[model samples]
Target: MRAFLRFKNSLSLAFVAFFATTSLVSSEIADFTAFDVNLTLALLRKDQKIEVVVRDQVTDGCWTKSNAAKTAVEKNLIIAGYENIVPADDNAFFTIEVSALGYDTGGNNCAVYVSLRAISGEADRYYMNDHEVMAINLREQFSSSTLLTGPKSDMTSRINDTLYEKSDELIVAINAARNSLRKKISDTTISEQKKNGLLSAFSLD
Candidate 1:
């Protein structure tokens, strides 16, 4: 009986240790992903232009539906110093596409899901021995959901607000990453010219 009890306790302890290690690994992976995303966002420049596209997928009579979500997204992008263009301009630096779905859950209650993707207008190409090679563009996406209980007349307004909030969040993240990169460049021991070059490379100046 004593042996069996000891073995059981040991097995339980092993399971706990395994779960703890797994949790730690997951946390590390999340941190690495966030860092990678921030580095990518730091490459955006204020002077660059971005194309905006929006899709609405809400179908309900209770909600006042219109082009409010798209307008909100465009407004936020313009506020962030990005020129919003349509029809996918080849000269644009990025294309921001947004999709929004909403649900009216009876009596002034609603839920919305919004997703945004920023795709690089230019592709990264690999060349070998002056021969044509492969090229791929970068895409980053984020999503958010919100639930609100308000007057029926305010449904459209609330949806627009959510869209604006998500767009602003993305811009804020990019700015934060850009500022961090600039600060890192400034703190380095490199010469002023080299520092400026680095900043320019990252579109920080």
Candidate 2:
């Protein structure tokens, strides 16, 4: 009985150690695919009005580093030459950061755009950030405009940018083509009883 109890305690200790190791591994950045982002505030004041940009855009060809992207937006809040009575955070605010999963493409291909949001009590609070950061997302946010013509608009964006946004028919056709390959995979994972069961199930219905 004592030997059995000792064995049980040893098993419990081993289980605890295993769980501890797993928890540590889960918190660390073991994969390059996972990362951290820092969003900054970009705010400016002009003509009795203020503009602010916040949150990095999640599109293609954006900031390489999440933290740097975030810091860029925060620069707009700096008011070196201002009157007294200043608030701690300053009412004009903005935040910028890279998308967590980078808009979720198929593989390691990162065409994701860093987000930058500007905010102010002036005309259109979201567009107050500096041109460099705001240009990244505003172009995508209002891409339907015909005014942005010339060589820029004709450039081919990444597949997910427009392909995912395409019509339902295109989406269906893509799915059908992909599923055809799946059917081939299914054909190989077959069994005699599995085949009989599949036939019987379909025929009965």
Candidate 3:
């Protein structure tokens, strides 16, 4: 009987040790969503007449992604020194939509798909569409045998990280697409004075 009790105690200690290690790993991942919006905005320049709109369907109940798009637009305006441009949406020559495609979970992984589309004019189709996929490496915390049985807290943290990564990608894609629009506007045959005025206002020089 004493030997059996000793064996049970050993199992209990091992279980505790395993969970403690898991908690430590989870803390190391950090929360990516906490810093993504501000970081992305800092990296983008306000050098174009582009408006940012985060689709409601994508950002619904997702504050991190929503703030990312919102902050990017605000930062772009600030960087261009055009904060005075009221009703930016109406005056903007181009609109960029940041949308969330969907989420995928299986195969020991969590994946999120994000898309960006640029549109101009009432009849003009989207001039650019870009997609980015962000994923969390679940293998580090889960194995095939225990994939679906991991701690909920760990899984939630991983998903947050993926969402944040995807938001950052959207920011980069929008900036690049907006640059393309800028080049297209510059190449047009508009009058020099009008072109220069628009360009200067947008800080596109």
Candidate 4:
């Protein structure tokens, strides 16, 4: 009986350890994704140009509203003081791709999925096929879904509101990163030339 009890306790301990490891892994993944996102946002400068592309995958008779979605996203970006372009010109520093999937449920209820991806135009080297290859290096994404119930106009307004909120969130994060960079620049331990180089990299000059 004592042996059985010991085995049972060991099993319980093993389960606890397994769960603790799983939780730690999940936290690490969240932190990694957030770090990448902040890094991408931090690279943006006020004078840099961005491109916005919208894709609509709605099949519930709401595909026609894709144009409106694109317009709303562009308007929000412009309002946030980010210059937005179409067709992704050569001068664009980053490209934001917006993918939207919408469904029209019964009784004027609608479900929408909105995703945004930011990709930097800068390229970096990576190893593949036993050789070095260069490709666009930075990318990050965010997505959310919600249900709306209202008239067509009201629904449109809600969608635009969501876009505005997301744009604001992005700008806020970018500003936070900029503030952090500025703080680093003011650190007295760093050499003056290194500080100036950092400023130039971020276009703070």
Candidate 5:
């Protein structure tokens, strides 16, 4: 009977240790959104640098041990910036908190909040997302000749512009020139030979 009791105790110890390790790996706390992180990165100028403060929220019903997981996440972010921007999603580190019970079980999911603050007022939420940023290594999206537009602001090249390219101005101009030539033909009262001469002068051929 004593040996059976000792074996049971050992099993319980193994179970507890496994539960603790799993909690350490899975528990996360985050309160920032991806919109905020992307906006902040966009505001960075060619040589300018900005600091971001990422934090997660704690729910009243959170388990006491979840705090350690939050700390681990914070340490990782502080040491290494979210360097990769081409993540499957923008909100990679953000965490969502849900009310769950028991030690080995976690809740459904949680939402994260992310924020960026430029030390100087020169940067705002709009500037972060709307303006070009230099800190991130963004991959260029591929475009075909049919698409025409490349990701460039200056349209000095034959390649189409990223924003606006291949406007219908050429078509409109051609139509206007044709109409003017037709009007000249109608206004002429010369003989057919003279009319043909005038048409040739107009370069309608």
Candidate 6:
């Protein structure tokens, strides 16, 4: 009887540990493809206006040596008309970090990976941190090239093309994440009055 009880306790402990680890992983690297923009926007409709700031430190790796990631962020954000506010704004805001950007030209040919994080608010009031990763491959274009041999210019061209192709997708992810954060703030920290005040102050009402 004692042996069975010990076994049960061990299993319970292992299950708890497994669940904790799974939750941590899920919170750390959420894929943007799974984002629900409509739901998040609905949740944020009445909340405070938010600001955006882009991080300068773009992730560097094999394919990122050419500033492809940074260029993509600048181009896409500009196209989307996203305004980067200063510190004096005093409203709810989020900073975008380009956490990962790289390419792999091995095994099955070419692959591009991009990761972004949206860190909401500032200081103690800060509440939400969301992350998303997008990875794509060019098997159709590079499957025949076993050596992956290409000039720097050619690689740059391919990288730019891929980044442009995924630019709209990245914008969608950012929009979804921003709305999700607004929803979180609405549900948890800020009061209705504060939200209304913020909206009024920003002339968004």
On TM-score, the leading prediction is 1
Clashes of each: 0, 34, 0, 0, 11, 0
List where candidate 1 sits over 4 angstroms from the true fold. 1-40, 89-93, 106-109, 126-132, 141-152, 200-205
- lDDT by residue for model 4 (19-112), tens: 3433322233322222223434554545556777777675555444556666776777777777645555554647766666777776766666
What are the per-residue Cα lDDT tens digits for candidate 2 across 13-51?
A: 432443343332123221100012000111111211222
**Best model per lDDT:** 1
lDDT of each: 0.58, 0.27, 0.39, 0.55, 0.28, 0.38
Model 1, 1-205: lDDT tens digits are 2332343344334324433433322233222222233444665556555677777776564345546667778878777787645555445546676666777777756666656667653333467999867444445634455555555567677666776787887888778877876786566565687667656655567
Model 6 agreement with the true structure over 1-205: per-residue lDDT tens digits:
2332343344334324433433321331121111232222222222323333332222223353435555565566666765443242554333334433334455434444433443443111123465443222111100111122333335445554544445455466546555664454344344577555533432334
Model 3, span 51-156: residue lDDT tens: 5665534222222345455555456545545353234445443455545433324444333344444443211113345644432221111011111222332443
- Scored against the true structure, residue 124 in model 2 reaches a CA lDDT of 17
Better of 1 and 6 by TM-score: 1
Question: Where does the lowest 10-residue lDDT sum fall in candidate 3?
Answer: 138-147
**Deviation (Å) of 140 in candidate 6:** 33
| Residue 85 Cα positional deviation in candidate 3, in Å, after optimal superposition | 5.9
Please give the distance, in angstroms, between residue 30's alpha carbon in candidate 1 and its true position after superposition: 20
TM-score between model 4 and native: 0.63
Q: Give stretches of model 3 more than 4 Å off.
A: 1-50, 56-65, 82-91, 104-109, 122-205
Worst 10 residues of 4 by lDDT: 28-37
TM-score of each candidate structure, all chains considered together: 0.64, 0.22, 0.32, 0.63, 0.19, 0.34
lDDT of 1 at 102: 70
Q: Relative to the unseen true structure, what is the C-alpha lDDT of residue 67 in candidate 2, on a scale of 0 to 100?
A: 40
Q: Which ten residues in a row have the lowest lDDT in candidate 6?
A: 137-146
Model 5: ten consecutive residues of lowest lDDT: 28-37
Q: Relative to the unseen true structure, what is the Cα RMSD of model 1?
A: 16.6
